[model samples]
Target: MGGDPVTHGGGAWRAKWWTQGEEPGTTGQWGVWESLGACDGGGGDGGDEEPPAGGFVVSEAQFNQFFPNRNPFYTYSGLVAALDSFPAFATTGSETVQRREAAAFLANVSHETGGLVHIVEQNTANYPHYCDTSQPYGCPAGHDQYYGRGPIQLSWNFNYKAAGDSLGIDLLHNPSLVQNDPAVAWRTALWYWNTQSGPGTMTGHAAMVNGVGFGESIRSINGAIECDGGNPAQVQSRVDKYRNFTGQLGVDPGGNLYC
Candidate 1:
């Protein structure tokens, strides 16, 4: 996994709120709501391009095109699907909210997935060998390492089985499918993000990354909370980055994360 794209780019640094002074508003309440404005441009038919019924919309190809060399494995279409579907987790009417959430969510996803192009194939070495190292399931007698797969990188036989059941894909028996199919992998990621819970809302994954403990804080989501390779110093590093970003805006700088 040394050369793995997801772990390479962005390394493991995000921004945090300032600890020395007054912090910003709440983490997952008003600010996010304000960002999610009304759907209608004053009021209209909702439009054709409007995301299908409960779905949202985004240009996955365009997102990928933005980082061509970084991500070249996952399909542009699959990225788009994940982006679009991810919003439904927030709410049906909150298209704006969904979009805002999606923006924040993608930041973390990009960091974790090494962009959207190569995530599926990046770390999907462990498959079909669900049993413990000592047991080895029904694997080919000598096989042992059964790591994980996809963007959020679904792992563990239990999780794979759960993801497959919810998404109707059968990942336990066919773990490799996550790497083989971008849509399957993307859906699994979306499912995890939408369903998981924690200190701060998982709605803004990047925000959580910058604000909380990775495993203890983010493990509610389906993926392992190992922070890729980030530690507390690295977490603070990300906080510094986001703080710098917020600093340019002249808004109130937030406080240090408790975690």
Candidate 2:
């Protein structure tokens, strides 16, 4: 296939060529390129290009296999698009570590959204409780708008504000974006995975990268409500999914499978 045109130092033009049928922008250092220094007078026509899949360890086919009954709204492309926001997600540590991290993440996501079937929280009764008026910013999007949404079920007015601030999306005021835009929804989940520790001692990303096991990742996400016999069934559900996903990825689920 033809390459994508890229401009480098001193106006030097280059065509990014792929070998072995690899997708563009997905190969990282594995890509081959021909450096066509300096543009002359001739114009080169470039074909329409598809967005990069971010070269994640998990492919679209694998993701589909993981969530066959997923809601159409939770698209694979959206998840790929959101990967740029968190480069270190599944790219850290060894190949096994990388696959494990991806599996762990998707496992948690599957549990949270019920195999990616639900886009937003099902219960409407808890909507008003997500709004904490005591916060200085309060709930600009109204008290009931902050109900759980996206892969991680991000909720609460304060969480919306913090996620918005971190992602530069103003989710505090436009909380619906989490449910409306698939990329935004996935980004919120990634934001929580890579940044927030929740009730745990470390972020989910840290837990996997540091070899702290998948259980710690669950702890980081919802230990306050699920860990230490708080809800063994819930914790086991996540662990079961993690093991299944890791098996699909041909990797061990690793130690500390429970929080």
What lDDT score belongs to each candidate, Candidate 1 first? 0.43, 0.82
Worst 10 residues of 1 by lDDT: 5-14
How many collisions per candidate?
Answer: 14, 0
Cα lDDT tens digits for candidate 1, 158-251: 6666677877776666777777788887787777666555334543344343443233223343223334443555444433433332222222
lDDT string for model 2 (124-228, tens) is: 999889999999998888989999999999999999999999999999999999999999999999999999999999999999999999999999889999999
**Model 1 lDDT, full chain set:** 0.43
**TM-score of each predicted structure versus truth:** 0.52, 0.81
Question: Residue 20, candidate 2: how far off, in angstroms?
Answer: 14
